[model samples]
Target: MSPAETALPDLVDSHCHLDFPDLVGELPEVIARARAAGVGRMVTICTRLKNEPAVRAIAEAHAPVFYAAGTHPMSAAEEPLATVGELVALARHPKFVGIGETGLDYHYTAESRAIQQVSLRLHIEAAQETGLPLIIHSRDADQDMEAILAEGMARKPYACVMHCFSSGPRLAEAALEMGFTLSISGIAAFPKSQELRDIFLRTPLDRLVLETDSPYLAPPPHRGKRNEPAYVAHTARALAPLFGLSLPEFAARTTANFDRLFPRAAGAQQAA
Candidate 1:
């Protein structure tokens, strides 16, 4: 490894899309780069239930990679609704660590709001039943997202992390109030993300984790290009000072937060 890669603190990419085309064609190199940069683990998310098997295969083939399966909110209208039983069954996999990048995304598909809510609730129920953290992707529907999440908690508590949380403070506060975590992605490392950074600054360090959301939001030095897991270190490096932490200290805290939210992944790491 180069000096730069060697200097990176160990961290986890809590959410990414390794099975997606941009990364899948060069999976081994991508994973090797991640490890070289001290990204010790990653959770590749399956956005459609039909693609779970393929996503699972990626995790099984790579020691540091784990997987989660659910119907993404944006795809809810076109895809078949996921059954809670199905999600619970998938959670039985040793490497399957969380549920549903599922939640409301009314940004582009506002027409499908009703089905999106239905999908989000089903995913929440599965998280409640399986004891796995619910990985949420919310956008442009904060009111309904907050209300539904509250409704789920009212029925029964479940662990969750708001992935790529670039939403309003109200939603952030609501999720934190419900014992959920907020995942910091490369978006937080962008030059114009001061407002987003401010929101994270107010959040407790223990309630935060790190993700790449790759191949999507690559941080500075790689912005506007395809994102990869290794770039998560840049995000940690950028935000560490906000919490009065060194890079290693910030990485350790976020990795711990990830482990707390996704124990199965942590346990698997321990066993390995």
Candidate 2:
């Protein structure tokens, strides 16, 4: 391995869509490439409850892959709104570790705001009831997201991570204070994302995790190309210098952060 290649530690793609056609068509190859790049585990995120079977199948078919069950805000109208009991039943599977990829996304469409709020609350209630961590996706709706999250936390405490955070410092601080972790994606590696990088730089490493949001936001040198789990290493490499740590150190810390935030997965790892 080249020095840079060797520098990659056993990393985790905390969020990815392996169920999507782009990567699903070549599942074995995708997993192999990720393995070659030192990705020890990957969580194939579910964007719709309707696809829960496929998502669960992907995780069941792979040794180091797990899955989450939730509806994405963008697809809220497409699937039935999740209930705490329904989501809890779905999460009973061995590899299921989280309750959502659900939250507000006002950038795309404002027409679904009410539906989005209802859907998001369902996922949050499920997380609280089951004690499973939530994986949230918020975009251009930070105020609504924070209000809803704060309200949810007040009802009952549950762990959650803000996936692909590209929000302002206020939202970041609010989420952090609520004990929510922040996950940085390949977007943080973009040139115009210095503001995001600065926000991440200020956050504690223990509350920071890494992801690719794959088949989507590939980091530098791979920008505009279809991203994959292997590219998460690049995101980690970018964060290493920002955090003043070696690549291995950053990977280890983020991996630990991922594990701590998703205790069910950690328990599964120990049992395995």
Q: lDDT tens digits, residues 1-272, model 2?
A: 57754664968899999999889999988988888787888899989888899899999888879989788999987778888898999988878999889999999967899999999999999999888998899989989999999999999998999999989999999999999999999999999999999999889889998999989999988999999999998998887988888888888889999889887666344212
State each model's CA lDDT, in order: 0.93, 0.89
What lDDT tens digits, residue by residue, belong to model 1 across residues 128-243?
A: 99999999999999999999999999999999999999999999999999999999999998889999999999999899999999999999989999999999999999999988
lDDT score for residue 60 of model 1: 92
- Candidate 1 structure, TM-score to reference: 0.96
Could you report the Cα RMSD, in angstroms, for every candidate shown?
Answer: 2.4, 2.3
